[model samples]
Target chain A: MKKYNNIADKLVKSSIANPERIYNYLLYISAAFFSVLIIFPFYFLFVVSITPQHGLAEVRYLPTGFQWENYIDTLEIVPLHQYILNSIIIATITTVFVLIVASLAGYVFGRFKFKGRGVLLVAFLIITYFPGTTYIIPLFRLFTGNISLFGLATPDLYGTPWPVVLPLAGITLPLATFILTVFYSRIPDGLEDAARIEGCTRIGALFRVIVPLSAPAVATVGILTFILVYNEFFFSFLLTDSSYNNWAPLVHGIQMYEVTTVRGSPYHLMAAGSILGLIPVTVLVFLGQKKIVSGLTAGALKE
Target chain B: MGDVILENIVKQYEDVTAVENINLNIKDGEFICLVGPSGCGKSTTLETIAGLTKPTSGEITVADREVTYLPPKDRQIAMVFQNIALFPHMNVHDNISFGLRLRNFDSKEVKKRVENAAEILQIKEILDRMPDELSGGQQQRVAIGRAIVRDPEVFLMDEPLANLDAKLRVHMRTELQRLHKELGTTIIYVTHDQAEAMTMADRIAVLNKGELQQIAPPLKCYNEPANQFVASFIGSPSMNFIEGKIRSGGFESTHINVDINIGNYDDLSIGDPITLGVRPEDVYPKSNSPEIQSQSDPIDAQVDVLEPMGDEIFVYLRLNVGAEDGPTVTETSSADQLLMSVDPDSDVSTKDNIELVIDREKLHLFESGNGNAITHGIGEQTALNQNR
Candidate 1:
């Protein structure tokens, strides 16, 4: 009994001494389980998309028959090519516009102090959570008929891509400005002082020192804006006409076609469409994963 | 190269006057150091000279050109910050070449200067490594190398050695002095450490509350501090202060009931109060030593704490009769902490009562209320009084 107690105590001591190893092992297993849980839905989507239209009814977890026909059928039923073009244009324009305007506003807000700056920042944050419907009527009126301000008329903006793209860019600007501002502020003040001492003008320092050092942060913001623009639906649905119909806008096409009203709906087709739409964005995020992680956590840990 | 001068330089930020009426003449090729405690405005004065900060009023001249309004780069000066400020993304070579590139220096000239500076700093092998890859000392050397490549008329360093460890800081202190000799350039260094200023500068400027207390060679500042502030600040184990009233040919202490003779200054009236200053090194433990006995009866203090450093032991003691109100047992308990440096080999320890004698000539005198030194030259005195 004494020997057994000594052995038990030794085992417990060793386990306690290296608790981190045991904790890490448990973490690895947990990660494996969570990965499977997340990937299962994606696997189901893939299998359903490939399954023949007739075979899908009997299908449970996996595809029964390999029929490329479903893809062709789905493509023919909707204006897929035109919708893809519109999505590319909108996402590209929104991301580019957001990044440019956000970085400019972010630099000013981050590096300078002026009266009402805090109030302006708080106002932006408050508006962030307010419903977009509240602003829609006012925006529509402004675009339809120019409002005069200080003896100048605001430019007429009707039925143009500017109405959709510009509004999306403006909506994204505030938060992007806040994020980039924080990133900019966290850069060591020594760097700017050194640049100024090195004969760099304020603009020169921003370009030569601040910009190069901010590459990772810039990449992070760009990827996030791209994802936000790619996945947006409500604004695209409300603002777009026949000429502006994007792939996200086509999600409404299902409603007009009497698909959403049917009982026990053809969800397999809708799921297939949703899965296809995620491909481009997934590719982009995967390519920029490292930069995104580094940029977001840049200010988190420091010496 | 032209001499630099600050004329009635004043910097005010809202209610705080960071620097006030500082007048200085920095000769060409002179290495000057600004040393002071925190909030003393040594850094503010340096920044104002560098054009990194604009004075609220007054003018600064560098290389004979009035540059108070000029930008830092146009001032033909370079500054090495306390943090070093190396470009982390670039290697040492590129960091050195950046300024030259901005000025559109020839590619060949840029490479030659970069290589030369790297060789001088002995960082030639690590030229390809980014700043983050190097150790603190190496990064510091690289920072200096970057400055060397610019070859500016004046090099300003704001406590560059502060980030280094004690051992490395001492080593680099000598290295910097050697570099200054070889380069023969005017340099302005800022630090709160008197030892750094003493070791590296041809002259030292001590500041307090944005005012220049004194500017002189290290020894001169030490031997002849312009005011009570400089006397106390410029030494380790700081100079000890004793407050008393001037008596006939001596100083009379209310608590101790003892008097110290002041040869000629005894003519100072009996009612006038004054501060008597003495450096720890100038005060000795024995009345028998010829230097100690020359003064009448030496001041007596009881030992409190003895700190033994390798070369010297610091003896902290309290005057048995201390403060003004009474025998001041409580105040004496706190004021009992007087530091005196003795040879480390001495057998003295705590609890031993010791006599402290001041070298009369070395003793400093100041008006009790205003801590200014009583010096002659009424002409210079007018300017001094105006600053006050």
Candidate 2:
């Protein structure tokens, strides 16, 4: 038993001594595997897009040559700048509206007790679970009828950004409120009590203490809101016409034109567009990367 | 410093009453401890005095001003909570001077008061440190310092020493007493620990089940409890209660009967059930067997458990008694078992049947039905003294 124990101890010591080297070797293998899984398709697309229109069929894993002029041709064929602007405006408006409405509702639901609080929460959940397809027909009729309020009348919303941004904002409200509620509830009650003792009224405590203490929670909500608003596709595609090209519609447009003979397989432009679309989100992820991981994992592991 | 008065204060929730008809008059600069078990309304009463809670019906006067409806911030009172509710984001100086800053004190004034409070608590070195950076004891000191700089009329503390370890609790208890003396602030502290109450209270108010049981000096409450609950609640290794019958001349039981020459209760009938309470120190070992006069009671009991506690052995004795009128005492006094403090060096063990003697003069008799003392003791004429 002693001899076996000595052997085990020696094995453990050697393993510990080269832990960093072993870790790096494993990481390198995994990184190579994932990179191939992700980057290969993009590489193939680049070769397809940039190769001369006649050389497309002979395209293999490696690019024959670069034909960067296809990007200018693709831009001329599509309203690329209009799509980018529409996407930015829609996403920015949705995120701002969703955050403000959700935080107020979240604060009330999280901290206050009143009649119908639970019922209101359940109502929000039910609205979230309600199928979006069920509203499409009613929404189509309203857009056709030019639904008007006291004075403000709805315009031709089918091809406008309003329909997409408005409905998407409403849909994101419940989820934003839900996430913020969970975040707000996790803030320690002691902080509120401390603020109360320090001569803070209820509103003062909420703004001065609870909000500051819930910074990580707000950041988590902000990042999730940005990502969700930025990536929403169903409303964007269904509501906008080809003239009003949003990012979601852009992706769809590229796919449709590539497969068709009108723009036979412009894979390189699609890959470059994919790469461009991935930049904002990738940068955002890096900026609040630590908070994202912490927020995501916090729900899994409790201290 | 301020005098606080609660007149017929009542706090009731939907289905439960937290504090019921509490009437207390606390003098200026007095450190009064409201001590009881959980759900005893001591903490609720303290919060009521701090104007943190609106009593269901009552009048609260602080410094002779009716302030029952006032908000806590306007009541000129500060509190230290059990959880040490210090602002985690604020530095120690900012936390201490939060109220001063809120009340719009000038920068120099806030700085001076914060520095003075930090110096007094010896936390000046950590003024720039956040609350989370400090240890539990340091956090507690900052909590107190925060309350101090406000210079509130009353310092309401709700079990402020409960979070510290045993050794630190003891140290903080002494510090609290010293602070109370130095600041001369009227403090209403609530705790369940009797030691904390006895050590620091100018007067300890004992509560049970939302009712004020008794309020008196520590020694007075310990020596002359108004009711059985106070007697049992105040002492460590609590007062032992024995069942017997109060008769003419003395008390009697199945195990043994005692004839005490009590000055009063001569007309008390025989066969009337009563309980006799005696402190552990009152029951001595049998080695010093003094010459018993004819009026003494000698009750012999078998030792059931022996607890050697350095200074004395806590000897658990079981009396051998059986009868139809066999005083049905509850498990708190199970089957004639008694705990007596004997000399530590005494060679006593379990299974040893020891003959013990009771000093009839020190015996306390209470009616079993109501648990009130049947006999009374002498009292002097003082403004704060209770009538006997």
State each model's TM-score restricted to chain B. 0.90, 0.90
Candidate 1 lDDT score at position A136: 87
Alpha-carbon runs more than 4 Å astray in model 1: A1-41, A52-60, A69-86, A107-117, A144-159, A203-217, A237-240, A244-277, A293-303, B104-106, B254-268, B285-288, B291-310, B316-356, B375-388
**Residue-level lDDT tens digits of model 2 in B1-388:** 4999999999998899999999999999999999999999998898888766789999999988899998777777889988887776677888888888888999998888888888888898998887767888898999999999989899999999998999999999999988998999999999999989999999999999999989999998898888788888998899888788866555676565666443435535777887878787666556555643322445776777788999988988777633334323352256377778877778888777567776554566777887887653321122222121
User: Chain A vs. true chain A, TM-score per candidate?
Assistant: 0.74, 0.69
DockQ of each: 0.28, 0.19
What lDDT is reached at residue B38 by model 1?
Answer: 95
In CAPRI terms, where does candidate 1 land? Answer: acceptable
Error of 2 at A21 (Å): 15
For model 1, report DockQ: 0.28
- In candidate 2, position A78 carries an lDDT of 57
Task: List the pairs of residues colliding in candidate 2.
Answer: A49-A268
* lDDT of candidates 1 onward, in order: 0.75, 0.75
